[model samples]
Target: MAKYKVTMLKMGTLNGEKSNMTMGRNFGITTEIPMFSVAVEGNGHKIILDTGIKSLEWARVNLGEMYVIEQEEDETMEGALAHIGWKPEDVDIVINTHLHYDHCGSNHLFKNAKFYVQRAEWEAAFNPVENQQCFYFEELFGWSAVRYTSWKFLDGEAEILPGIKLIPFGGHSVGSQGVFIDTEDGVVCFAADTIGVLENLYENCLPNIMTNVEDGFKTFEIVRNNADFVIPGHDPVMKKYQTTDFPKVDKIR
Candidate 1:
């Protein structure tokens, strides 16, 4: 059995309404959420969980002024990889929690890697409802289909590798999945968009953005019960848990 080291790569930040992140609370309040791409490295494998958005302009134009993006010129996808001693081509696998633009925007960068996404997510990207269009960019998906070599569509919970599992739980988006990693400390769950902040999970709140509110609550409970600790999708609070050995990297266990 191999124990993988998980690191959070901060791609950038986005400012949005607090209510948008935590359902039905903090209506007028605004908050900045950190955008990240988690790297699970070990056993000679470099698997990335969601390839964080690359275009600030596109995000602004699509998401609107309510979502303010703050990304430095140097904060490119390749640059984030290099921070942890990796290159774009060094990635072996790419797992998208869902097909949201922010999560899958940089898929083109990892052209050599195999992408693992939920079957429901793949279908939703192609035939998105009106509300989903803001988050799911058709052009980005088209680019990925033409650029990436392979894609593995999962139906439910399955172990993609020895100690890593992909658990599907729809909430933030239909067919959204969470990554579970067995580590030295315990099992760590990347809650993905199901819980974007610690406040959401701890306070038992759902994000305003969800395809199914009932599933969102259920997904939150599932994540809380299953993992030792969770990595939220867009929380800057994760920075406090950074590993001393790796700069800009947070350890799950």
Candidate 2:
């Protein structure tokens, strides 16, 4: 057992007045256009979650041409980590909420780390193309930086690793999922794109894209009702609720 420090590193931010697209049906009214990931430190190990989007070049051809991204802090992941006194290779584990381009583009950045992805997502992502607007594509592969990949094949409350539990939540994707960290601030669930933004917390619904909107709603309810800190997809409000409480996320100086 271990304790973790979770920080929302601002990977990129979308600057537009009408950021929320009219996502109809189940999901509705998303707020903010920010991409985030968590940095974990403690237990004599370093871990991070969801690498965030790639350079806008990849975004231009794939993740909707309208999805323009600007670097929030450093030019590259390595440079960004150095600002906080970490190295790309320092990360021991990289969690994949799902394989969407925006969420996993930087997966290769942590070259020496082992990747933990949901079995369903890993299967779906590598299989035939699913979405016409699929954020990830074959073009994004062949980086060769990921030393290894593992799957959470079996379910029923599995611990992804020490202090991190891979709870089940198949939304956004067939096996789209999230993480529950017994962090210093309590359990922080990384519901990647599972809930597009904080609004999903209140609405308790998901868009038609989700495999099962009801399941998505139920998943959201579970995370929102139980976790100490709920990390929603693309929500910028994380920067505010965060404090210098954990190691990787907290100030080292």
Candidate 3:
């Protein structure tokens, strides 16, 4: 196809400002994070990755429950789209990097769009014990328009549209995937929460947590080296990578 444009849409902000107790000592990790809704504008197709936060219903209901992390803000997928001058329905395809709450919760918002998921990820969320939340699988069902567009596990590289492709970076989750799209400027990869912050690269360290540590490290290097432009997950650095006013997305040589 012709040239394409990739834009990082800020969905909203999440307050992860609260401190978590690890080994009884107070760890000072900032809680508030910038949620994002990434888009790929190809010749005639548009593909989106990871629909940001859906709502705080789960946190509000399970306030004191363990594992119920509360977010400081409530920027739904719809709000992010509105801010970008687009509608949730305008997205042609949706990619769920993994089944994590923050990543896939907004899948419901794009009920009309075709869903693309890794085969292993879909099955992991499909099986009873393998699944975490019911909505993980339920949200994709009963929607007459929904379809398992492409399975990344079986099909290593599947182009989302023409220029938008899914890169399997497994191990973060069973089938945690990354997206690589060729834009008019250069190659941009939607690396969902893999090497979260720029620091995730500086030290060449894993997140201290992962489904598969070894695999995570290897895949991380590949992502870091391959993409001409890497848009990290959760961090606000995507749009703020360069000058504030100009927002120049510099291509790595």
Candidate 4:
């Protein structure tokens, strides 16, 4: 097995209703949500888990005031990559946990990398349900400049590399997946929207934004069973676990 080093790249932050992340709880509270892209390095390859949002202007014009999205000077895709001494072209693979605007917004940057997306996700992205339609932006991934040959659409669980795997569990969306990486300590699962915040997993609460609450809880168990350390999709606490000491202690069972 090839052990890899994982780094969480801060893409930006979103200010939104806490209920959006914790389901029925925190209905009247607002919070700052951190967005990230996981960088996995090892096995002589460099991979990016997600690509953050496009830009503040793009978000404002497309998403409006539903939430305030902001990216610091060092949080752009390029900036974040540079912070880790990486360039877009240097990326060997790019795997998207899902195609929501925030997760795939910077897809256009890594022209040299092979992109991996679930077959279901690729289909749903184009014909998403009414509510999720707002989060799927074609301009980001459907640009004329990107070649079709760059994509590898998966069907289910797949070990893309020696120790990196893709786990698909549609709940947050019609086709949301999570990335599993082998590390020195154990397996680390980048539980995307399926585990949007720590509360979702700890409290067994589904995010109100999910497409299927049942599937959301199943995904939670998936993380608990497989991951020694779990990283939530948009938790501010993620800042402390940029590397493999993830979550401070072993993930909650």
Candidate 5:
């Protein structure tokens, strides 16, 4: 069995509404959520989960002033990978938890990697639900130089490698998936937007951004049942586990 070392890469930050994350809660409040890309390295393979956001200027112009995004000098996707002794082309597989702009923005960087996305998600990226339409940007994943040629779509839950499982549990999007990587610490779930923050799993709340609220709640139970440790999609607290070590459950808070 290959014991992978999972590292959370902080690519940038977004200033968003609190209710946008907690769903129906924290309505008049705003919060800063860190954007991260998870790196799973070991067993002669390198994999990335969710590729982080695009340039700051692109976000401001395309997403408007409401979605203020910022990326520091060291927070670029290239910088994040370099911090772990990796470059984009060195990655073998890129799994997109969902097709949101913030999650797949750097998909183009991995020119030599195969990009995996759920079949439903690939379709939804082209024709998302009314509310989610604005969040999907085809250029980020489809119109890139690598384009659809290097893209692969999964029908549902599948394993990309021996110790890496792609669990498609949709709610956050039409085809949202989570990456479960077997680490020395146990199965660590990179619980995408379905589990936006640790509080959502601990408090049994749903994120405001979702295609189906009911499915979002069900995905929470999936995480509780399967994950020994969890890395949330947009939580600042995950920054503590940015190292190359396999993080244990107790270390997450």
Candidate 6:
């Protein structure tokens, strides 16, 4: 097995109602959530989990009203990558856990990388119904088409590299998938929106934003059973494990 080093890249942050993240629980509380793009290095490959939101304007135009995104001038996907001594072109693979605007917004930056996404996610991105419309942005996909030409649409579980896998579980999005990476400590699962915050897993609460509640719960169960360390999609608690200051990256275990 190939052991990899995982780094969580802080993209930016957002303020939203706790209910939005914890589902039916904590209805009135509001909190700030940290956005991240996990970088997995090993097996002679540079693979990124998801490209965080592109820019403030992009967020404002697409997701601001819903998520209330707040980004500083320097908090950019490119800047984050640079902090890790990497450029977009240097990325070998870009794995999208889902196609929500926040998750794939900066995908256009990785022009030279092969994008791996779920087949259902690709379909939904192109043909989102009313319930899924708010999450998928046509503009982002249009921009991505122009920059990223390589795409590998997957159906279910797949081994992208030795000790690296993609497990699809349609919950948060019809095509939401989690990336499982083999690491020194054990397996680290980037559960993505399947488990949006630490509380979701610890408290056994599902996220409010779910396409399929049953799938969401199942996804959480799968992650808990398989992963040694799980990384949630939007949790500031992740900052506690950060090992690098420049990129604000966190180690999973």
Question: RMSD in angstroms, all models?
Answer: 3.8, 5.8, 5.0, 1.6, 2.5, 4.0
lDDT of 6: 0.80
In model 1, residue pairs whose N, Cα or C atoms come closer than 3 Å (at least 3 residues apart or on different chains), thus clashing, are none
Computed on alpha carbons, the lDDT of every model, listed in order, comes to 0.79, 0.63, 0.59, 0.85, 0.82, 0.80
* Model 3 stretches with alpha carbons more than 4 Å out: 17-26, 62-74, 127-154, 240-253
Model 4 agreement with the true structure over 47-84: per-residue lDDT tens digits: 99889898888898989978898788878889888888
Shift of residue 200 alpha carbon in model 5, Å: 0.6
Alpha-carbon runs more than 4 Å astray in model 5: 244-253
lDDT of 3: 0.59
TM-score of 1: 0.90
lDDT of 6 at 17: 88
* Every model's TM-score: 0.90, 0.81, 0.76, 0.95, 0.94, 0.90
- Model 4's C-alpha root-mean-square deviation from the true structure amounts to 1.6
Model 6 bad stretches (over 4 Å): 143-149, 240-253
The candidate that wins on TM-score is 4
Candidate 6 minimal-lDDT segment of 10 residues: 244-253
TM-score of 3: 0.76
Instruction: Please say which candidate is ahead in TM-score: 3 or 4.
Output: 4
For candidate 4, the per-residue lDDT at 247 reads: 66
Better of 3 and 5 by TM-score: 5
- Is 1 or 3 the stronger prediction by TM-score? 1
Clashing pairs in 4: none
Clashing pairs in 6: none
Residue-level lDDT of model 1, residues 1-253, one tens digit each, is: 8888888777788887778888888898878878877888887899998877858876767777757888864456787777678988889899999988888888887867989988989888888888877787767666534353488889899899999999988789888999988767667888878888877777778887889988987887777667777888888777622542221112231
